[model samples]
Target: MSTEDIDVMVYDYTVAHGAIPAPLNFMGFPKSCCTSVNEEVCHGIPDKSVILKSGDIINVDVSTIYKGYYSDASRMFMIGKVDKKKQDLVAITKECLRIGIEAAKPWAFMGNIGAAIGNYAHKRGYSVVREFGGHGVGVEFHEEPFVCHVGKKNTGMLLVPGMIFTIEPMINMGKKDIYVDAANDWTALTIDGMPSAQWEHTVLITEKGAVSLTY
Candidate 1:
């Protein structure tokens, strides 16, 4: 299936549940969701020309606005028979996200999230994308507190209780260098053409710890 096919399904399903696809028309984004494949890092517009094939790994990022609230999440999918390296990259990327989430304790520094994720990924010989990272998103589609995936621990904003944000770390199998596609001015890809994977979760910091608002 093409990326546009994925967008249509997500649009219909979100509307069916009485929710609005937040990315539609937001900041001039035309798609209901983002589909990043292979070397594509993020902000990949859904296009009918982009078709899925074997060994392809894609990230489908979906955001929803419901009853004046917003939700964001993204997950990677392995198409057909993927290579061992690609599979490992996908698995390790997911693990990095898990580590980031675990480190996001209530009242902790926002840098803790990035530090944990960066350390784990770097130790595994992977790199984290720097151009884009997670952000505060609940009252609005995007908010303050730019959350980087690589930083020193105990720095940046403090994770206050009742605050909502996203922890999305784009882990690349090769170097971290990336450049934006000037054509659409949205899609970002790895400069070295290496495979990249990302996993995201909208989180809420509670008194006890951080909880994922998106599954």
Candidate 2:
């Protein structure tokens, strides 16, 4: 299936389960899914007023509960013909996510995941958002083992089989500083007003490697 098909599936899953299946109620998110577009860093609630345009980039974040288990993942996509710079940023961001996932294994430190992502972003002259990072996911919505996007090796939690979580890397075109939309209480944007991109995957660490649950 295409990337668009996967996104639709995720959206449907979230909608079918409704807000009750999401743990955001405890955090006061007030939304079932997040569809953030250009200039909208994260937590962008989908709405009719927000229509995707041809050169726009969007990130769809979805989380759902199934059989008492919760799964979450996100993907970034280009609406149509976006500029080369933005396209490169999006491509590189996805690669960073891939590299992070590759480093997620049994006995691996959570910081290694962030180190891989951060190093790639920095080498490409981009900054990773340090405020919001990955976290453990499983029976509950969000759990232990906080994963920072920028950290030193062997600094944080250790990865082990049976551990499920997400590794989302938010790359900024300019500075790492971010701003939240107080009025809507959802949207997040870069303080410098530069474009940003992000990619995420709900992963489960197996005896061998990590499996993407929401793929």
lDDT of each: 0.95, 0.81
Q: Write the per-residue lDDT of candidate 1 for residues 131-184, one digit (tens) a residue.
A: 899999977999987889999999988889988899999999999999999999
By TM-score, who's the top model here? 1
**Cα lDDT tens digits for candidate 2, 110-194:** 8889888999899999999987878888778778877788877787787889888899999998999998888976689999988
> Lowest lDDT 10-mer window, candidate 1?
138-147
Model 1 lDDT at residue 104: 91
Which parts of model 2 are misplaced by more than 4 Å? 1-26
RMSD of 1: 0.8
- lDDT winner among the candidates? 1
> Model 1 residue 155 lDDT?
94
Query: What TM-score fits each model?
Result: 0.98, 0.88
